[model samples]
Structure formats: C-alpha cells, structure tokens
Target chain A: MIFLKFLLYVWMVLVLLGAFFYAPLAKGLGEYTRVMYFHVPMAWITTLTFLIGAIYSILYLRKKDIRYDYYSETANQLGLLFALLATITGSIWAKMSWGAFWNWDPRETSIFILLLIYAAYFALRSAIEQQDRKAALSAVYDILAFVTVPFFIFIVPRIYSSLHPDPLINTQGKVTMNGKMQLVFFNSLLAFTMVYFWMLKNKLEVIKLKMKLKQLES
Target chain B: MIKAYYIFRKDLLQEFKTRFAMNAILLFAVVTLSAVSFAIGTFTARQEVLSALLWIILFFSSMSGLSHIFVKEEEAKTADTLKLVASASAIFLGKFLFNIVLLFLLEIIVVPLFIALMNFNVQNYLLLFFTLFIGSFGLAGGGTMVAAIISKSGAKGALFTVLSFPILLPVLVSGISATKIASQEQGWMTAYSELQTLFAFSVVIITASILLFDFVWNE
Candidate 1:
C-alpha cells in the first residue's frame, strides 16, 4: 500500500510536469486550454466514481454484503466531492474561454444535473434510518441515477448542437489532435484515475477500522 | 398484466372515493397558477416563457400528490399486505397508471384555466396535447419510481423533488421545446424532434423502473 501511495505521487508529479512543460499550447485557446488537463480528468473521475458506485450498488443488492454497500456509499460520496470540484474548475474554464462564468452550456448543465442526482442520493441516505433498508434503497437509487448519465453525456450535447451553435465541439464529434498531446492528456487522465482509486481504498480502510472499533466497544 | 389492472383499479377506486390525491393536486395547481398569473401580471410573456410556466405548474402540481402514491401505502401500513397480494410490476404499473390518470385530470382542469388566465394562445392544440400526454407518462414513470424509493425514508417531500428534478430535467427540456412549437404553430416536423426525445425518455425511464422495481418493492 505504501509503495502504491509512492507510485501515485510519482505519477501525479509526472502529469503536472508534462502538462506544464511538455504539452504544446493548444490552438486558439492558448493558455486557457491547459485547464482541459485538469478539467476533463476531474469530470471523468466524477463520472467514473459514480459509475463505480452504481456497480457496487448492483452487487450489494444481489449479494446482500455490507462491505459492497459500504463501497457503494463511499464511491458516491467521493463521486459527489469530485463532481463539485469539476463544476467549479469547469466554471473557471468557462469564464476564461467563453467570457462568462456560467453559460448553461450542455456540459455545464450535464454536470449540474449529475451533482443534483448524487446530492439527492446523500439526502436519501440521510432520510432512511434502518441499515439494510437504507442500503437497499440507496443502491437502487444509485443505479437509477447512473442510467441518466448516458443521456446527459450523449443526448444533451446533441440537443445543444442541434438547437444552437456549439462553441467547444469540433467536427464529427472528434477533436483532431496529434499523438504527443494525446499522450499527455491520457497520462494525466491515468494519473488522476489512479489517485481516485488510492483515495477510495484509503477511505474504505479507514471506515472498516472504525466499524471494527465500534464493534469492540459495543 | 391483469394483476396490474387490479392494482390500478384499486388505486383509482380509492382516489375517487376519498378524492384525496385529486383535491390536493388541483388545489396546488390552482394556487400555483394564481401565483404565476399574479407574478407575470400583465407582462407580455414570450411564448417560451408561457410554455415553460405551463409546465412548471404541471410539474409541481404533480409533485404535490404523486409522491404520496407509495407513501400512502407505506404510511397506512398496507404496503406489506399489498406486497403479498400483488407482484412488484403490478404495484409499479398500478401506481404509475394512477399517477398518469391524475396528471391527465390535472391537466384537463389546469391547462384550460392556465391558458385563459395567462392569455396564452395555443396555435397547435394537437401538438400541445401530445406533449403534455407524453410528458405525463415520463413524469409518472420517474415519479412513481422515486416515490417507492423514498416511501420509507423520512423526508419524502424534499427528497422526491430533489431526486425527481435531475431526471425530470431532460423531460422538461423536451416538453418546453415541444410546447413552444405548439404555441408558435410550427409545422409538425418542427416539434417532431422534441416529441421523439420525450418518447425516448419515457420509454427508457418506464422500462428501467419496471426492471428495477422488484428490488425496491421487495426490499
């Protein structure tokens, strides 16, 4: 675990260096585009964690395992934290690129909706008292929320483009990029994804220890 | 399927006998309409604004009563008895059907009063009706599912709206756009895309709720 922690830090440092020094300035947006390195990855981790939560939710429902339920709840909690960060960072990027902090861009709206969905998840959790009942309900809710992510990601963007001019989307829904930039982007993405797993692992362990302690005391 | 109707019939019977859900839905609808009319008072509202307000009224009005469908069963302690008698899908369908009927009835009374009071003109009545019709199904599907999830939770009032908003947004977007087309009297093709989107959303939510209902209902 210590080795893994060391490796994650090393990876993160490499990504930072690559993002600032190695990655060439993207066209048009110049300095503003650098935000993409963090913004996109943060958004990715947000979606990934919620999806991870939903998968664990499904497993918990099927297996009736308290551990899986804990993982699901933890994943959603982390997902909400990452989603909020992404939204703030994204707003900053929007301010720089679009000359406004909030424009109701499809991407912005998608993240906002995602934030609400998970916020509701937390609210649902708090409102239920029974252990197994709360877990069951939240797990089902998690899966239901996950089902909408695809609609937001794909359909929302299409609605925007068809209804209005898309400032950010490139032709054919693909942004043309050379291999080097792709490498740096993917590198940062991988580094952040690793960071997510490490945090989640640590969170789970801490909670597990707390549960054991509670059991011993009781 | 037959069992589903039995649940539906049962809910309809109960709703009619007490007029409980109906009265709550209409009172809220009328109150909201009155407030909106007062707020927008004499402003020459745009068609989009008019379309949006109509849905806002419908949305909240539905929320007033729809959240109670399952909560009623749980509160009345009939959930367990119903659980024994009906399959999960039957209960889901029954509740969903009842919600749809409630929304339809709400629209019937509210939409006319909404247009008359707000002086909102509908150029394509057919399209407006279709949008509301499809939107109702989408709302019922998602709302009933959420009501079930939060039935035993403490904060039904807030959780239902908070949880419903995000999922309902896509529906509202399509509904607003479609309503705009209807108000503007745009050609059928103009509203087709939004119609398609609304239809797609309804299908996805209902199918998902059906498949997932067993776990939520049984647990």
Candidate 2:
C-alpha cells in the first residue's frame, strides 16, 4: 500500500511537471507543437487502455470471472476518458494551427468515431439489467472494437493526406526528437501509464467492493 | 447457407409487405436532400458538392434501415423467437442483407433525384455502381452490428446514428473517394485497387460481426 501511494505521488508530480512545461515548450516549438506533449500522451494512453481493456475482456470471456469483467470495465471507462481528452486537446490544437476547431480530417474524424463507438459500449452495458449478459456482450464488443481501432487510427489516416502529423514514435529511431523534448516526451508517457494503472486499480477495487456489498445484502 | 437465405428472404418479404424500412429510409433520404439543397441555394453547387450531398443522404438513410431491423423484431416480440430458431450469425446476415438491399433501393431513387436536382452527371456508371455497392456493404455490415447492440437501449433510433457514423467513417471516406474517381471516368485498372480495398473492408467487418454476434446477442 505504501509503495502504491509512493508511485501515485510520483505519477502526480510527473503529470504536473508535464502540464506546466507543455505550454512553454509549445511556445518554443510552435503553437501546434504544444499539443504533442498533452494530446499525444492522451492518444497513446487511450490506445494503451483499450488494449488493456481488450486483454481483460478476453480473460473475462475465458474465465467468466467477475473480477476480470470489473478490470475490463474499469479500463474501458478510463480509455474513454483519455480518448475524450485526446479529442479535446486535438481540437484545441487544430483551432490554433488550422484555424478550425473541427475539420472533418481523417484523423480527427476517425478518433471522434472511435470515441462514439466506446461510448456506445458503455451505453449498451447500462441499458441491460442482467449482469452476466452485460459482461459477456460488452467483452465481445470490446474485443471487436479494439480490432477496428488499428484500422481507424493507422490505416484510414494513411490512406489520405492528413493535417495531423505522422507517428512521432516511428521505427527509424524516435522520429528525430531533441534531447530535452525527448526527456519531457518519454517522461510524460511513463507518467500517464502509471496514472492509468493507478486509476484501473482503484476502480477495480471499488467495483469488487460494491459486488461484495450487494452479495452481503442479498 | 440455406437457413441464411431463408431468413434473408423472410425479412425482405416482410419488409415488402409492411414497407416500414423502405418508406422510412426513402422519406428520410428525400427530406435530407431537400434540406441540403435548400441550404446550399445553388450558388456554390458543384459536382463535388452534389456527390457529398448524395452520400450524406445515404448515410442518414442508413440509420433508418438500421433502426428498423430490430425495432420491427422487438415490436412483435419476435426477437426472442428469432434468436431461438436462428443462430446470431444467421440473424446478422439476414439483417445485413436486408440493409444492403434497402440502401440499394434508396440509392436507386435518391441518386437520380440528386443528379437532377444538383445537375450532376456520372461519367462512369459501372464504376460508380461498383463503388456504391461495396461502400453500402461496409455500411450495412457495421451498421447492422451496431444496430443490434443499440436495439437493447431505450432511445435506439438516436443511439444507432451515434454509434454507427464513427465506426462507418473508413468506408465512408473510401466510398466518397471511389465515387469521385469513378465520376472522373478513370480506367478500371486505376479504380480496381481501391475497389479491392473497399471489398476487403466489407469482408473483414462482416466476418468479424458474424463471429462476435453471439456474445452480443446472448448477453
């Protein structure tokens, strides 16, 4: 528990430092570049969360364990939050750079669509009253939707010339980042991943507690 | 395969009898076209604009087709019965085929009306049809899956569009791009590759939905 608390503190400090320096860095590089620190991290975390959600979904399907379902649900909820943040930050960047908050560019539009798809997943879960069916159905949807995420994020955008920049983390040695920028970029990535795991742990614990309470009452 | 065909035929026959899906989709298409045309006011009207308008009409019309799929089943309390008799894959295939046919019918009506209203001409009718056909397949496949999921929700009609449009973006972009190329009278060899991409998309989505349907439905 102490170790977890220490990790949480470290994550919080990293996030604050990243957020603080992101603006000055943007002003230094260009207004559009500021989005790289925050928006890109959010986008990366969203993908990471979705992948983690998909893994838990598979485990839930295989084991039919309520705990795995809780984990999957927590990851999905957090993924949606990060996806929304990515969209908002991207939109703000677009307004500054492209002079429009929402252009129907392939990347922008595809991410927006991704957000909607996951939001529907949650909506579907809430609408169903049966617990077993909700977990099974949502698990299936999560896996299937995660499969399509690559098509939307990578393939669809590549098919068209997008205003959004190409993958900064590329195969050919990190897409040419300077030392200071790399420090900030890699640190933010690590910080966000830690925060995501922290949130997932807390959320899953809460879900398990609720289930225990319900069983006790019954 | 025969069971799938039977289910598909039954859906088509029932739809023909009631005209619920067809009428809703056609009316929605017409209204959307009229609204967009009115908004554009003919000053900035061009073939590109007209093509986009036709696609928007088809996109919105698809939502109606999607909603009608399970709404009709739910209204009659026949969804449970259908589920017991037919596998989820069969039901998905049936609904997907029905959506494709419905969208095709709407396209037949709306595309010409759009051309007349917007003064657009098709330079390559065959290529345009191929593009539209493949694009509609993707839309119907993904849309039917989403519709099934959303059907369990309270506000299904609204939920269908909200869930589908984003998931449908890849096909929409490819469809619009293919249509533009076809409209330019491009050679078959040139358009063939893009057509292949769209076909691959449709196939993958349809298969994925089929494999995943039981989980969604059983749940």
Model 1 chain A poorest ten-residue lDDT run: A162-171
Tell me the tens digit of each residue's lDDT in model 2 across B1-219.
677788899998998898888888899899888888788886756666667667878898888776788777877888898988888788888788878888888889998888788767788888888888888898888888887777665556666776677667677777877777767675787666568768877888888888878767766
**Model 1 lDDT vs. the true structure?**
0.86
Give the CAPRI class of candidate 1: medium
> Which DockQ value does candidate 2 get?
0.43
- Which parts of model 2 are misplaced by more than 4 Å? A7-35, A91-104, A169-174, B38-44, B185-197
In model 2, state the lDDT of residue B2. Answer: 71
Provide the TM-score of chain A alone for each candidate, in the order shown: 0.89, 0.88
TM-score of 2: 0.86
How much lDDT does candidate 2 score? 0.79
* Alpha-carbon deviation at A119 in model 2, angstroms: 2.8
